[model samples]
Target: MAFLIKRGSKKYPYITARVRAMKSKLMPREVYPKLMNMDIPEITRLMGESEYKQDVDELAQKYSGLDLLEHALNQNLARTYRKLLRISKDEPNYLITEYLRHWDIWNIKTILRGKYYGAPAQEIMDAVVAAGQLGYRQITSIANMESIEDIKSALANSPYYSAIADYEGGELSTIENELDKIYYSRLLASIGKSKGEKLSLKFIMTEIDLKNLKTLFRTKKAGLDKDVILELLIPGGMELKSRDLKKMSSLSWSDFLKRLEDYSYWSAISEVVSEDMTSLMDVEAVLDKYAIEYASKVSHYYPISILPIYDYMLRKNNEINSIRTIVRGKKVNLPDEIIRKHLVM
Candidate 1:
């Protein structure tokens, strides 16, 4: 749910057109296949020729190989998201910003994980995507913290303060879960009661459902207790209700898999299950692929709405991941086929 107050003004036409244009300029599908066949330097050269050329060139002086590529991709993603935020206004602004809070979750999670492991501030900062409400300064401040307690103190005034407060010095996964639940609950609450926000609502719920599915699957694989798993599942998903998750958590993995066949993700889940019912990687790959296809479908179905903006953001994120996979795979001399399997597209 987003807390966007509509001003009785409409500017979707302008924003939609701009987003569509941006979508068109994204690297075409064929480019991925070509990049898969390239060596690390060749992939770098290719990025140097693409829209990320500026980032590649600027970062090239300080880093090389996969490191350079990853840093460049992070910078490029942040830049693109900021540009989208700048273009947004009214309802679109609210919708896009709500979606972008994803980065806030990402930044906070990165900070927490880094602190948990005692990672260097620069290493944590490298992973921070300053595309959310939290700017680079705020994220940097959090990253510089010496401990989880210090990080929580820095975010004490934010929405995550209460969530982080309860989990101070607690398990990383618990803190991450609290952050997610808080983000989604507040988002839905902010959307309030409005027919106009229907599409955005559906979109967020779909995202939540997918995430819950992943979490449930992982927990089941780990042999976690039914009640523990149930406690971790997020509410407000489109199809997966609390009662449904609780029931699923109580069942065996095989029974849980059978139950999943009743949902929209059944087709995608079935493909991976058929391939290797025990392979988490295969299951995750199918899930990510379905997410891309679903987002694409939603974007096209509501071309003039705020969906395309979200669609662009997801696709851009996938691109960054794809590029990182390609570069990292090439650096390790992994086969193109294996590299392709790791990609979302």
Candidate 2:
């Protein structure tokens, strides 16, 4: 997306105000409790009557049931982010776009998975969001390609190429992890370009920390070697160092929880950890709650800056994810309690 304003321009106040107004229109937190009790058709009908109506209406002709809801959620996410990109200018524009490029990393991973699994090109294409720096043409080109190697070749000139180059012909997981590293590195580098962007940087670092912690817990449970776990850890986390993670990976699960109890995350995580060992999803729930709370705090702390827009984007995405969970759960005829448990809200 092109910037609407040139260098030396400062449009943060206007853009922040607009994003705040948009945030106000988000699906209220109280609505989800009621939605969890609804069936698939009821959920779909509720969505149709809300802000998602346009996307639902547009896709309803070609798709039905959960498939339709899925398509509409994806569409609305891309459309909302696209609007943000369109209205933003200068530093605000650059920072917002940089944050959204995480989806590019996501799209690449999806393509690789599809290629390895021999999924149809259309199926692969349908999974793409096109919300990142890569345009529709580039995403379509990658999705249309027959193999992961071919997708790599198509992206050879981009920075993403470097992430895959060293791991060419390696295990798919290796390549995927490399992409994760590259995405975080680029995120930090972009934050560096914008002076006094502390809140944004903090949020990004918090995300990296959560990701690393999740990986650590998973690897520990899998009984992976400390060296292998260390190798897999991404750098630049605010709380946990690579060395600390290496040690934690080697510790017993109980010991690991003991260590976590000494940190800020303990309050949220302690409830889930026990002798039987908590599920990975439980740990993730704590992290997700902390992240949302952190973003909310940041937005209020810096009302007339890019922080609010970033917060809005995160909240909006969470809402989309919650709705998707409800749709998927209802489609499977899952219990309402089980469906509600999956929602972030």
Model 2: per-residue lDDT, tens digit, 107-149? 8888888877888987887777778888778888889987557
Which lDDT values do the candidates have, in the order given?
A: 0.84, 0.81
Model 2 bad stretches (over 4 Å): 1-9, 166-170, 193-196
TM-score of each: 0.93, 0.92
Candidate 1, residue 295: how far the Cα is off, in Å: 1.5
Largest lDDT belongs to which candidate? 1
Candidate 1 lDDT over residue span 1-345, tens digit each: 233533332578788889889999999999999987777788888889999999999999999887788888999999999999898777778877877887899999998888878889999988888999999998888788787777777887888888788765647887788888999998887784444378889888888888899988899888899888987889999999877887898988778888888987897777667523665877788888888888889888877777787788888999999888888878788887788889888
Clashing pairs in 1: 1-187, 1-188, 2-190, 2-191
Please report the TM-score between candidate 2 and the true structure: 0.92
